[model samples]
Target: MSSLSPTSPPPAQSHALLSYPSPSILLVTLNRPLAMNALPFQAHWDLSELWSWFDDSPTLLVAILTGAGSAFCAGQDLKEVQANRLQPPSQPYLKGRPPSGFGGMSQRKGRKPIIAAVNGVAFGGGFEMCLNCDIVIASPRAQFALPEARRGLYASAGGLPRLVHGAGIQIASEIALTGRSISAEEGIRWLFVNRISKSQETLLEEAITLGREIARLSPDAVIATRGGLRDAHEMAGLEETWARTKERYEKKLYGAPNMLEGLAAFMGKREPKWVVSNL
Candidate 1:
């Protein structure tokens, strides 16, 4: 699932390799392995557009973000950072990551779900991307860290806040402030990783299986459910989050054909035939 030979079909856009492993699945492989998949600023904007396309695409319900080689991502290319320091970009948009943050994963509140399949090293912006994903399935060899502090930088791409939101302030402080690398098994303990794969060889397959499970559900239900879950983490006040979730998806979901189809499928004792989400 990771290899992208020159013989492979052209990438959907830039800075990554895209493949439709399944009708509902998008497998996005970060191909900059020589640099341990470290992404430059422009790469972030390219990825933002790619995710926007995925969110707007009716056919893609789930996305899997991985890397071509031994690193998920080492975060922003430090070489790029140093270059920017030496010779800053003349234009505003060229200076840093887009609003979607690093690789369009961190700070992303997209309509569909993204599953982080951490194959190897995930540091800095890489870890930030994992923090925001709905689910993270990691390889046994996978490693995560927020090493920005070691570089005299903090996780400005939204990792720190989301880390605290996910695993409490203590865990967040320990991970971010210490600049230590955590293993995939430890990630499970910290509640950052959903599961660890049997081995690195099987990581993508395991992720695909999980994504398919979600893809088989009512698309509208999935979107609404994801909205509710994200709201719990991103919004304040229980009652306010609850009310906002209802207001956001209720009317559309209640009237959607997928809603009716799901119930009918249950009553009839058959698998639901889902359509793309219009929610």
Candidate 2:
């Protein structure tokens, strides 16, 4: 791993994104507010690259994805998409990228967790991005929708599947078919969002607190648990899932240093100092 630089050049302007480090968390913000932080062609590629960067950086235990200005993300920039001038790259940005998935949430699987801070409206692709996160904390004013059906397009980029997986078949179908928007409160009721805050600051604070809590746990354990859950969801029978989970515990997590620290801290009635070699 490389040393953390105090100063680093901003991500390419075409990318127009900002990455800041906070303790064990990486704060990723979409930076093109002029377009309502709408994702352009390059933005998708940049997001893919950013996810890879975070996966490689061991110090970054968690990521908080949010947008700058008023909108969490206004979905793909309509003008850019309609123009069709920007051809897809010869190679997919995420091809051969770490399995932590697209934008770190798609097909990728990683040890670290990601939290989405939906400070404002998340529509279409933006809403899908929120679904990709392990946890979502939304501001009270935030709204979510999948307007692709109304626009004569479909959110094929993990939106349909993730929504079904996260919010279940019925709710996902309603959102996709009707192209209706859901309030932050409704999002919580549907289990799409973990919590709703009164404002952005509170939402972000809650995200940071959750990230810190995750960071304090055994990294291996966290990864294994996440992987197990993901696999279990995909697998057929409970026995198979349990077997895989047992394998992970026996082969990886059991008796780890962090586990020892966790036990010692419990006995000593103090906070544990989690030590992870690979970060």
lDDT value for model 2:
0.72
- Model 1 C-alpha lDDT per residue in residues 140-175, reported as the tens digit of each score: 999999998998989999998889988899989999
Which regions of candidate 1 are displaced past 4 Å? 1-12
- TM-score for each of the candidates: 0.93, 0.84
What lDDT does candidate 2 reach at residue 83? 56
| Candidate 2: Cα lDDT at 5 | 29
**Residue 138 displacement in candidate 2 (angstroms):** 0.6
Candidate 1: lDDT of 227?
95
Residue 107, candidate 2: C-alpha displacement in angstroms: 3.8
lDDT of 2 by residue, 1-279 (tens): 123322334345464455554565778887878777777665666666666666666555678888888888878777865555466436554222234333435554555578899989899778877887788999988999999989898876677887787779999999999999899999998888999876767877788788878766666667777778777766778999999778766555667776777789999999777665332
Count of clashes, each model: 0, 6
Error of 2 at 259 (Å): 2.1
